[model samples]
Target: MNSSAIAAGPVFSARDITRVYRMGEVSVHALRGVTMDLYRGEFVVLLGPSGSGKSTLLNILGGLDVPTTGSVHFLDQNLTQSTDRELTQFRRDHVGFVFQFYNLIPSLTARENVALVTEIANNPMDPAEALALVGLEARVDHFPAQMSGGEQQRVAIARAVAKRPDVLLCDEPTGALDAKTGIVVLEVIERINRELGTTTAVITHNAMIAEMADRVISLSDGRVSEIRRNERKRPASEIVW
Candidate 1:
């Protein structure tokens, strides 16, 4: 991490970032000169249509991918300038990600799956404690194969938070589940954000979830189309479907 480079301010400061993908003679521009500031302990919801560059922005923020132009400064580390190893280490130390699919190992029990991450974390929480945080204490011994979609997603959240990361990046975490199942998963995520203060950013197509967030950022055509601040965020359970 570069100490002198990171300014004393927001957790993330992205300045005019652009991501371009080439397919032979054709090129795709995902993010076009997008700039933003993401604060710590903030629950932000990103809403956008398909191919609107929302996921691309989240990927850059998570250090899963780099921008072709501009910079992303995370807690003083220039994410766009790090090597593969540095990026990997940075992700291990500073970030946690939850996606649409619950990627729990089928052979491992819930506890063991979560334990896999804790073992590598610098100062990880106990696997059991993480599971308990997501209301899965009794089902810790169950395998991924035995759990429902919602339960599996809860396990994913537990695994992500076990590391006590500074950032939690979720991309359509409830996309694969039904309405009821998705709400349950959302509740778990909200609870984790409130309890752990994990500075969460959740990107989703379901605009209803925006009610539970501290702010909403809407993206269109690779730019921040709108940013709305909520005076008061309702509880996850109270969020209207």
Candidate 2:
């Protein structure tokens, strides 16, 4: 953890958390006694392979899923004990999620796509402001089909951040783009984390991306294998596949 982050305390504290999925007669453990903390304004990367439970843990932290055992605290609120409605409210009020694929509506322009989130948020950035923040001011009127994959992904990012959520949870945010374009998307995310001071956690299989994080947490076979803090974090522009 960063020293500053430690002094501020954690925005999220998860303890002995585990998730078990039952498929017919068999049980699959997605998380095994995962304990972690995400501090305000710090960038952390969850590094893992497929089925390593990074995504599951991210979802749990974002209130998309609850663990079968243990507890998760987002500030003073216990997410594990929240009802479905409370979890929904929790996600709406505090979390911003960016997935691998851009989930923009095809018919909506970039500004309109971002407006969908701002409309429901308690407090939000103007859609145009959010688009500008992601370097998409010129593309605000462009529809999904008019944009490249990277551009569309930026629009997705714009939408997620429009609500000015407390935390930005990204899952393989650049997995679908080429190295050059992926670097661009990462630059946007990095800028947001720095400028907005939104607690950010990104999940990736690419080890090179970990260099940009304040901490790198390695996960394997549903368990956290290692956690290391970066003494000198690199900028996203210097990262490559």
Candidate 3:
């Protein structure tokens, strides 16, 4: 990739964002003041310990939550100023999110779970095609209860990407899986980013996962502590830990 392309303005820009929770007499500052950019088609790893505000920031970026102060822009649109209905539309049309839990409906088969999204999306891939992207084509007929943790997670991923959103935001996507399974999950994510060119951000507590990111952003006490570029990005299969 050219340096100029990498330096091009970000797809998502956040400035002076803050989030605070008031617990009666106590005030919890989840994000002090976070400013960052997520470049187009780049895979970013958000590396932080628990309570570091990585997930909070991801939620803000994805329009699931808003900051107490400052502004966030996705492309030319200001998310901070968008109405609830507008935000909902924005999320439905532009963003895809995968959480730590599979959240697949127990009664639905893998293909049906993915079809639930594709059916609503404006321009969606076939449910089976989405499953194939995640290496789950053979398991499309299996229900959530019949699949392993990793397989279920892949189904969740398939559901998220079936709509072909511009960005993919994943919060602790591999948190519930074993080492081998987590790597397999990560490989799927990595493949999606590479092949589809979907800008992706992954929140992870394990620093070893940084090797696969185009850039690594580290958070400390709700603030960005460091941002580094990985000159030689490794495939997720080679990441240990």
Against the reference, the lDDT scores of all candidates come to: 0.89, 0.94, 0.94
Clash totals for all models, in order?
1, 0, 0
Model 1 gets an lDDT of 0.89
lDDT per residue for candidate 2 within 118-160, as digits (tens), equals 9999989999999999999999999999999999999998999
Candidate 2 lDDT (Cα, whole model)? Answer: 0.94
Cα deviation of 117 in candidate 1 (Å)? 0.3
Candidate 3 lDDT, tens digit per residue, 8-56?
A: 8888999999999889999899999999998889999999999999999
Cα error, candidate 1, residue 193 (Å): 1.2
Stronger candidate by TM-score (1 vs 3): 3
Ranking by lDDT: 2, 3, 1
Candidate 1, 187-209: lDDT as tens digits? 99898888787889999877888
Candidate 2 segments whose C-alpha is farther than 4 A from its true place: none
How many residue pairs clash in model 3? 0
User: Once all C-alphas are superposed, what RMSD does model 2 give against the true structure?
Assistant: 0.9
How do the predictions measure up, each by TM-score? 0.95, 0.98, 0.98
